[model samples]
Target: MASPPPPTSSAPTGFSLRKIAIPAFGPSLLFGIGEGAILPIVPLTARDLGASVSMAALMVALISIGSLLNNIPASLITMRWGERWAIVVAGIWSGLGMSLCVLTSHLGLFATGCLMVGMSQAVYNLARQSYMTEAVPITYRARALSTLGGVMRIGMFIGPFLAAAAVHAFGLQAAYVIGIIGVLGAAVVGARIPDLPVPPHPAGQDAPATPTLVSTLRDHRRVFLTIGVGVVLVSAVRASRQAVIPLWAEHLALAPAVASLIYGLAGGIDMLVFYPAGKVMDYKGRRWVAVPSMLIMGVAMLLMPLTTGFATLLMAALAIGFGNGIGSGMIMTLGADHSPRHGRAHFLGVWRLMSDIGSSSGPALLSLLAASLSLALGIAATGLIALVAAAVLASSIPTRRTGAGGAHEK
Candidate 1:
């Protein structure tokens, strides 16, 4: 809850906020647009492209696989290449890969194309996170990330509706066209972002230091594991809810469009609160809100099956949004707080990998469970998992050692 300590060092290259912010903003915006365009069409696209339901699901899964590959590399690249170049290069790769999805008509080829996109996303996300962490002041790191997250959610809000409209009007091709443009827009922004100086290396070790990357990661095993487990728990629950909500909507007999729209409102609330929620995290310590927020999220999920109307769904979404918004920002700040003075990139790389794994796996696991046990039972299990994860988070706030930064120190 303390204000962030002021910037110890100046921003790299002393770029004005405008110069840096716009560049960062561009990738997020384009990602939103592309994401928006893809969401409505993903299932239909898969079927049309000749994928089985399971294979179609794999199309989504492939992206997670790519994220898995890039999680650590993204951090490594930003440490060496400078944030701007790494992000731009990653954006270009992302654009090219997503565009490839449009060109392929074969199911096998389409799946491969999707895999490329996933990989590109991995690199792009890592570059983006590392870049923000390295290029900006530490005090603003969570805020900055929060702002971008807001932008992405906004894109999500619009992307699906727009993509759906595009598909309705011009068929599936329009969605890809828009996606290509969105990615290109992201590339442009990344391209314009100027590079920051590499983190200082140990004396006389002229090559940009990566030996430390390995060692730093190895030494902080517990911190990273804790972060990883937290990320996986949250992401899986988040994904499970998203996967089942539509089915829930269908059970209540809402039209497909109506179902998506219902989910969209939650995303909208999520976007709306993100900036202020992040500022709150900045103003308050991570646990002041994060611990309680997560428990509430679990409670929200526990109540999910109790409602059958859109209004109830909306309430669930709003509560979940609030809880998650605070939780994510806090966790991110926690990652920063815990990273060794010289090992932030390494720590963050691991932290992000945990998120990718969680986000990637959560939905699939839920979907499978739902098929066997029914949606309510599956969600109930998720709710229980949420309760356990929340309890873990609430209890896991580490007591500070002597000389710890800020108030945690004795």
Candidate 2:
């Protein structure tokens, strides 16, 4: 770990105080904004190209695969080439790839572009995070990360509305074009940010890579299993909820806009409540927060098919966000916290891989389960799985809070 700084309160919080923070967070806002600008049109885009429901869903599926493949490569590139350059390169690739997406009528080609976006997103995020941890006071680390979540929520808020308007007006292709532009803008911003200078390696004996991916798996097996199971369970819940909610709403003849509004509310709550959630983790305990949060997610799944209008659906969204805010956030921080020295890149890579795997399979699993069964039942099953995983995760994590409020090194 990098040498610790003085107390956080002594650090600046004004403009000059945030020099590293702003530069570090700016790219995320750009990517988040880009996400907002395009994510709404995926299904419409596929439909416009004459694809089946499953084929249209490929847009989301491929992104997970892309993220899964890129996790290790992204972290590896950061270790070798440094943060600023790798992130900018990722931005450029995502922009260029998405721009080409406007020309493709094939669902496969469209999905491929989405994959590149995930790959680029992985690298940019990995590099940006490494920079944040190294440069900031450890006490402020969770706050710094929470700030990004808020910014992304802001982007998500604006993005879907913009995508809806753009797709409704010009076309889905135009929406993608706008997304590419936003990604490119982020790349330009990243290019201007300077690379952090590496702190010198300790003197005496040197070795090659520590906790190589294999060793990391060996050492952290139980922790990974617990976390991985939680991830897949939640991912499945999210997938089922997202898939069924719109269809359910439509069956009642509700406007599609109401469904979009539901997601918007979830994003808003996630951003708004994250700081307090982090504070709870710091002052009280993370496991306490995480376990109940998982339970809440399960409850939200049960609540989904019951709501139709925007307002009621918003309640479900809040439940989903509340659960994710505590559980997933803590899980990610724990992944970072548990990583051995000189092995952060690999361990984080593994973390990202697990997330991608869960998300990739999540929708497909729901689709298969709901094929013969009711979507509501599939969703309830998701909740049951979450409760099981939460039970396991609660047992695994230490009860008391640690570093930076729960971000302490092992």
Output the number of the lDDT-best candidate: 1
Per-prediction tally of clashes: 4, 2
Best by TM-score: 1
Candidate 2 accuracy as TM-score: 0.83
Native-vs-model 2 lDDT? Answer: 0.67
Screening candidate 1 with a backbone cut-off below 3 angstroms (N, C-alpha, C), the clashing residue pairs are: 1-283, 1-284, 1-285, 36-159
Sliding window of 10 residues with minimal summed lDDT for model 2:
1-10
Which ranges in model 1 have alpha carbons more than 4 Å from their true place?
1-20, 199-209, 255-258, 328-331, 340-344, 397-410
Checking candidate 2 for backbone clashes, the offending pairs are 36-159, 403-408
**Over the stretch 1-410, how does candidate 1's per-residue lDDT look in tens digits?**
21223333323345444656677767887877875677556667789887789878778777668778777877777667766676677667766766777777787767776777777676666667666766656545656677766777677667777777877899887887787778777877788877766457678766644446668667777665664577578777766767666777887888898888877776666666766666555444455555666677788877887878888977876787777665545555666656654556666778778877777677766777788878777777777777776766656655331111223422
Give the TM-score comparing model 1 with the true structure, all chains together. 0.85
Residue by residue across 1-410, what tens digits does model 2's lDDT show?
Answer: 22113323333345232666556667777777786676657766777878888787777666656777899888788777777788788889888768756778777788778888778878876777666555544455555655655565566566666667777898667778678877787888888787766568778858645557787777667767766566565555555555655665665577778766666566556666766665565455556566787788877877776776667766777788767655434545555445554666766777767766766666667667677787767666677767776786677665545433344323
